[model samples]
Target: MRSLMCLLFLVIFCSVQMTSSANLAIEVANSNCCGVFSNKKIPVNKVVSYYKTSSICARRAIVFKTIAGREFCINPETSWVRSHVDIVDKRTATPP
Candidate 1:
């Protein structure tokens, strides 16, 4: 009976370790990708900054951060997205 108890404990420990490792791997993988894109347009004035998604991401996208500290993932090819990128670029280029 003692041996059986030890075996069961080992199995549970191994399973818990495996589950934690899997969750960590998934988090690492998702950190580089934006899972969804926002279709709504955010006014340029509301944008605080922008950045491009990682090259490894399947979807080409730009992430815009708003003054209110919210992030919006947008398709990079969209006309308005391009315009926003240009405006943000110019804003960052000049001296304050």
Candidate 2:
């Protein structure tokens, strides 16, 4: 019983740490120039505020790539591209 309790505590602690780390990464990501939907031009300052006000976290480092003269959110961990809603989209056109 004692070992089970210890294991439970360890799991909870690790989970919280992972969640907070992800949140921090999201905070950094939202501070960037790209918008969440991949189409809007949001102010950097506003983006910074967005992350601070929310508890949601991004699982990976967020990236902004300009492909074909358009902006996109590239989540490196999952290799997802916001513009195409696909895990990986080859740059169809030259980046601007």
Candidate 3:
């Protein structure tokens, strides 16, 4: 009876650990935060699309996805970054 209780406890502990890890993974995957910004200037024409980082992020930034399937995080306040975001937005905007 004691051994059975121990085995049940072990199973319950493992289940809790697995549940916590899965929750953490899901949170990380859902977070669209950028830890750092890239200083490299990506040509506006090369950017196929762009998106702003989530408000929950520590820093305000823009993410630009290039035609070559690469993503760059840039400071939203930068002049070039703002212009690039504007251009990309217009390009992707749906017709009224």
Candidate 4:
């Protein structure tokens, strides 16, 4: 009975630790703003390079790297960026 109680306590401690770790990871990911594209706007087609998510920022911005190597953040809700994203997704989904 003592051994069972110890095991239960261990299990509860591990679960709480996991939950805390997961939340910490999420908060860290959402706290850092993208240095390359903090506040700028540009056309989607002009984006020579781009990334899809908050991997580069605190929010869900479409980070675009222009031909000049200048980075800009564009809202993902814009029609231009959304349509281009759809096209890219469709293209990549096709079998070569």
- Model 4 misplaced stretches (Cα beyond 4 Å): 1-40, 55-58, 83-96
Per-residue C-alpha lDDT of model 1 across residues 27-79, encoded as one tens digit per residue: 66876568898998999999989988876577878999999999999988888
Provide the clashing-pair count of each candidate structure: 0, 0, 0, 0
Clashing pairs in 4: none
List ranges where model 3 is wrong by over 4 Å.
1-29
Q: After TM-score superposition, what is the CA distance of residue 80 in candidate 2 from its true location, in Å?
A: 41
How well does candidate 3 score on lDDT at residue 89? 79
TM-score per model over all chains: 0.65, 0.33, 0.67, 0.47
| Per-residue lDDT of model 3, residues 65-91, tens digit only | 999999999998888877787787788
| Candidate achieving higher lDDT, 1 or 2 | 1
Q: Pick the candidate with the highest TM-score.
A: 3
- Show pairs that collide, candidate 3: none
Q: What is the lDDT of candidate 1?
A: 0.89
Summarize candidate 4's per-residue lDDT along 1-96 as a digit string, tens digits: 999999999999999999999997887776635544354446555556666664534567776667789766667776677776665466447587
TM-score of 1: 0.65
Please give the lDDT score at residue 51 for candidate 4.
69
lDDT tens digits, residue span 1-96, model 2: 999999999999999999989977877676544335444443332221111112243333344343334344534334222433232233233466
True lDDT of residue 17, candidate 1: 100
Q: After superposition, how far is residue 42 of candidate 4 from its true place, in Å?
A: 1.4
lDDT (0-100) at residue 89 of candidate 4? 61
